[model samples]
Target: MGTTVETGPFGHLAEDLADLQLPTTDAEEWRYSRVADIDPTRFARAPVEPALESISTARATIDDLLGASTQPPSATVVVVDGSVSAAEAADPVRIDVHAVQTVQTEQASPNAFALLNERLCSAQVTVTVDAQARVVAPIVVASVVTTDGVVVAPRMRIELGANSEATLVEVHRSTGPSDSLVVPVTEVEVGRDATLRHVLIQDVSVRSDVVGSVTARVEASGTYDTWIAAIGGRYARTRVDCQLLGRGADARLVSLYAGGGDQMRDLRTFQDHLARDTTSELVFKGAVDGRAHAVYTGLIRIHPDARGANAEQSNRIMTLSDDAWAESVPNLEIENNDVRCAHASTVGPVDADQRFYLETRGVPTEVAERLIVAGFFDEVLDRCPVPGIAEAIRPTLAELMSGDRT
Candidate 1:
């Protein structure tokens, strides 16, 4: 049933490939997902390319992807076609680019896509912050895909030392409208008393597909905050897992996504509390237009030792067209009676009362609806830790709302 291989650098590629089995829609984790539509055999692994020669060229590429209005980052790492093309950093930050032939297959991956990513990833990039160092500017990582009918996997790890403070921005973009698959995985470790703010922006071509994963662990008295904006891709999905492993850990998760035309946006999250007095809160909001679809499923679990833990999860969706569809499911599993957990989810159209109030104040019906949608997203956008991301996302949201509103 399975083949086993020795563990080493670039070992067991053939055996791993032989045992890889793609997930199906029947699986609980894959339920309501478009996993069946994906044919991994259709795409080939990305070809190796030489790193960019000039720092100026790398900076220009980053600016082009992030937009001109974004502030200058303290450090920048650019990955193209799963390889580290360029890396630049300022003080108090260390950037390491490792060229690896293959991923260590000792541990099994969460899913087939993740396993494929592990096997095909071209390089591993790590960013480290020194202890107690407070960085004022954000560190930017730009992962770009530039080929068609090819698969690209990018792996990144961020480590924060004890009592350190930093902000990071990770973005995914395509150079052109290519029908490709991109799988990216990110790992984060927050040391004791450290604070980290992470902002993820996915704006790939609508012709491509993306499946990404993020995993983070917070230590005692540490805080981790993340904000995600998913605006592009034909079929885009992201799964985030955050664990509070030490007492007094805190986490805040916020996301905003918009889908239009025939696109599909899927998001899943898990908040795990394993220690006493830990807390976590999540808020996700999305809107669908035309025949687009959106799905969000989140779970908050508290372990028996997680006494006095408080966790909350919420997901809300708005449908702007009759043909659009949305699904929101929030769940909680608590083992300790002393812990407090609550979950809420809603899927519907614009609020009638809010629309009526706006129209009664002389705003046109169309303008009232647009305003309502804008106001609905602003609640989550306002919480974004990055400065220019929210500004750049507003135009996209506006364009989506400008479409036929039912």
Candidate 2:
């Protein structure tokens, strides 16, 4: 694929990448996270067919190793080897289901993989939720990046019509120990009075490296809720940027991430209020162990005309091991004094007092520690709008705390 420069409201990819390069140890965001260990030159582009059964079977081999339950079976579009499956699109919104490759890259801030995706991304699955329609089923989009020494760029575009409502669940999966690189980009447009709820789960294996970004536009009176969860990956970073374009728009952002055994995950979020009466809130929680590191950075901007805007952001981190590290930074750039904005963050280990209290109550130190960790994550889980998901995080957290490698 050849790269052609394009301009739009979001900005050009090449323009953004002019001075920006793929992250390295020198990069502020990559300081704690190192990527050189994964020899990028050894990666190959993934194949068309992923041998789903074979990989699924391999994953099952670990059933006895892990106590956490497997993801619930549901209607999903599994993208393997950089291509989406052609199976019928079930419970989709307004867009067609068939898998088609990329056309022209959209106008947006570009990065290292931007040019590659403009050319190599194999298929595009478009999904749109019509105006005023409320969709109940969660649209599940899963991707497996397994190519060795190759890079894959996947793009997903979602459009929500005026007054429409929908929920999207995107999952990232990896098979085996193959080295892989993936750059997935998502663009969302929320029409006037529309509400879009997005839940992104990055449950990749230990061998994959991922860099993803989501850009969203909310029109007048629209609402957007985004929840991101990342459990595993070699090197991972997720960027969420949203703009309230019309007056009276609202947004809610929540995220959870856990890193262990040399893995690293970084989250960068941006909330821009450009119109009057816009409101937004964000809450992010993270945990790190076994020399792993995590970072959470959030920015809330209120433009000059965004009077009466109310925005709040909070990030909290729990470090489980002495070798692990985590950081949180919440920033507010307010140009409108009439708006109400506040931001705060906290990063540290579990409360020893609480642990000692639990231990004094006859609980073993290990069990007590697990309980403390569980309680730390419960804050976010309890707020999960999905019924079963919140209840499911406990056991997962338990397995991780239990020191199981699975």
Candidate 3:
């Protein structure tokens, strides 16, 4: 193997990760994951700064990537191939490029991809909403990957000050059918009495793979709400860890995913209640078709000090074809008797009764199945934090059901 000559702010991380090995399915955290299939060394890292012509091209295509929307964003930050190409912000909000910072978390072990992202990312983008500020429009961050045979690491940090309220939209897309790797890491800090609504959309090429991580901390009386839509990629996986660190903190997570044609969608989540009166709720739904596979594993842990904590988790999946496969696992570890926690998971095909009802109502078999699938995801899509996300995804969902995804 050739040595990697590292350079940049995290250049020294190469030494620390020299002996570290990539995760395998043998580990519980990596079970059902395709980590063994990936060879990180085969892909080169993106340049520290993208070319001016590349930036112009990205600018021209940004609108098409984000889709048409009626409302203009309050702030916009565009990252092309892991480098910041354009950024603009409104009042009381700040956008920083190439900000060097390390995330501190106590709940999860060191993730190999996350560490690699920090070391190899061309730039780190930071968005901050000041205290007591209220932003009616959403702040949009678009991470675009356009090169093939390369690895792109995108890092994002969101900080909400006390008593502030804001909505953030993050979208990941690949401009071409590139066989590449994308490793992204996001860190969120919700301050006391703050409310932050976050939405993430992942729509990359089917020839590519993605490994992403999100870590968040909520302070006293703070609320953190997030929605995730995983619709594209050959093998797409995401892990989320949320810690309620102060009294009365609340966290809500919702996710929707669809897999087709040998694709795989894997999601893992951890809800940790460490303080008194903390609360959390999670709902994830997905469908697999045409020999595709889906996996959902989640855990809710209530610490001894987390008195009066309440937590709920639910994951449901539908298999559209006999060749498709899915797995759902939900667990709870409570150390406090005063806490209330419940978890439920189900893996099965579309409800026969619902399909029959639709068919008996004169709906065609294909149309009935499509309607059922759309209605199944409507529960989660209706709650999307972003305005146009649901509308944008409806057409894609229709195409997936019709096997027209290209």
Q: In lDDT terms, which candidate is top?
A: 3
User: For each candidate, C-alpha RMSD in Å?
Assistant: 5.4, 6.3, 4.3
- The candidate maximizing TM-score is 3
Angstrom error at residue 378, model 1: 0.5
Model 2: worst 10 consecutive residues (lDDT sum): 1-10
Model 2 lDDT per residue over 19-49, tens place: 5345566865456455555443444454545
| Runs with alpha carbons beyond 4 Å of true place in candidate 2 | 1-39, 52-75, 90-92, 97-108, 146-150, 391-393
- 77-118: candidate 3 lDDT, tens digit per residue: 888888787788967888887644786655668889987787
Model 1 misplacement above 4 A: 1-19, 50-61, 64-70, 99-109, 403-406
Using TM-score as the yardstick, the better of models 2 and 3 is 3
What is the per-residue lDDT of model 1 for residues 1-406, given as tens digits with 9 covering 90 to 100? 1111212233223444666787888998889788888766677666566235433443455576456445678888877767677788866888877643333332224677777777777777788999899988899998877767777788888889999999999988776677888888888889999999999988777888888888888999899999999887888999888989999999999999988888889999989898999999999999998889999989898999999999999999999889999999888889999988888899999898998998899999888988889899999989988776787788878876565211
TM-score of candidate 3 to 2 decimals = 0.94
